[model samples]
Target: MHATTGVGGGLSDEQRIESAAHGLLRDLGRLTRALLRAGEFGLTRSEVSVLDALAAAPLRVTELAAHAGMVQPRVTALLQKLEDRELVTRRRCTTDRRAVETSLTPAGRLLLDQGRQRMATALLSALHTTPIDDCERVVCAAQKSVATLAEAMEPEAT
Candidate 1:
């Protein structure tokens, strides 16, 4: 009757934690690959990321780069492509003519709306493969774990 033994009688706490983490990563990787292949909005991974970021608010090019964790030049290139597709628009910064801010166009919002539905459908289908109670429990625990990790990583109060 070891503390680590489960109903199956052979797993340690360390082993269970490791197994859960590995499974989560594998599931997420598979989910991401499927989403990319579905081409819900005809956007590349980088483009989807940029759009998602901009959905939060309009941002200058530099701010976008920071939020996207990309170099400014790469972000600029992505923005150019998004603009070409009419999914995003850039305007001269009122206070700084040398800089520009970018935001989603109406068309972009439409695209995001459709893309989100497709994504939700795919995610729901995947989750439905698991038991309902298990799915809810796992998702809740994962969200809490993520929040805890974020808090732990934040700079400590002075």
Candidate 2:
């Protein structure tokens, strides 16, 4: 916890930062919902989840199922649909011929990238009312935010 300001103030430093972060999350949730509404992406949220998982690296059906919180049978069915659409490909793993690895195809990557661009546009539009006033600061902040999030996503060293 941070101490209150020496002068009379409404919120302490910690409280101010916490509130700002919370507001950012809320706005992001709203932005995501707006982008996802009416199925504009032409992909179900579950299908998108699988693609997102594969964007990191090729994974077997079981690994994808675990990452996406779905059962192996369900993931297999979903993978079949994605593969049929040419959004993903499942091929024999190089290290283990018996195992199949699933990866995002070019089409799948394009869809995800477009969605990200749209979301970024929407988020920047929302920030217009804020005091940012310049694109450079916004870009810097966005980069820092992404770097921080990527760091958080990594496994902690033992």
Candidate 3:
């Protein structure tokens, strides 16, 4: 089993930590699902995932495919679709003769902006209407968890 997975029977400290991590992941999943269900924008999950990833930095098709956990051909097809929609643009990579880097267009950025705002407004209103603690704990814990995960996944120094 994976290290994070719990074994059968009684729980160990590792198992408890794993359980908590799983619960946090589930909560995040629920949050994503609810936001998607709100229907503020009609973007597909894959498109949204691509746009969001590109918002961080420009990436070549192969790099983007790796980042999106998809193969090059699939990502290439999606990039072509996004290109046709004017949601993204591709340019020849300056450093490579045979590679292209994909970046978001003004329209794509605007869509992401509006979609983010709509989701934020809906979530803020919902959370405020409830007696929750403003989601600070969840945000902080998730940030810390992601940082630790990044660190753990990094290659060891030679």
Candidate 1: 10-residue stretch with minimal lDDT: 149-158
Candidate 2 lDDT over 4-106, as tens digits, reads 8754367788877676677776776674577665225688878888988988889999899878879999999999999999999999999999999999999
| Better-scoring candidate (lDDT), 2 or 3 | 2
CA lDDT scores, all candidates in order: 0.80, 0.79, 0.78
Candidate 2 residue spans exceeding 4 A from truth? 1-32, 131-158
| Position 17, candidate 3: lDDT | 64
lDDT of 1 by residue, 66-98 (tens): 767789999999999999999999999989899
Q: Which candidate should be chosen as best, given lDDT against the real structure?
A: 1
Could you estimate the TM-score for every candidate? 0.69, 0.63, 0.76
Give the per-residue lDDT of model 3 (tens digit) for 48-140.
878888987788998888677788998998899899999999999999969999999999889888888887667667767554565656546
Write the number of the candidate with greater lDDT, choosing between 1 and 3: 1
Better of 1 and 2 by lDDT: 1
Worst 10 residues of 3 by lDDT: 1-10
Candidate 2 CA-lDDT value:
0.79
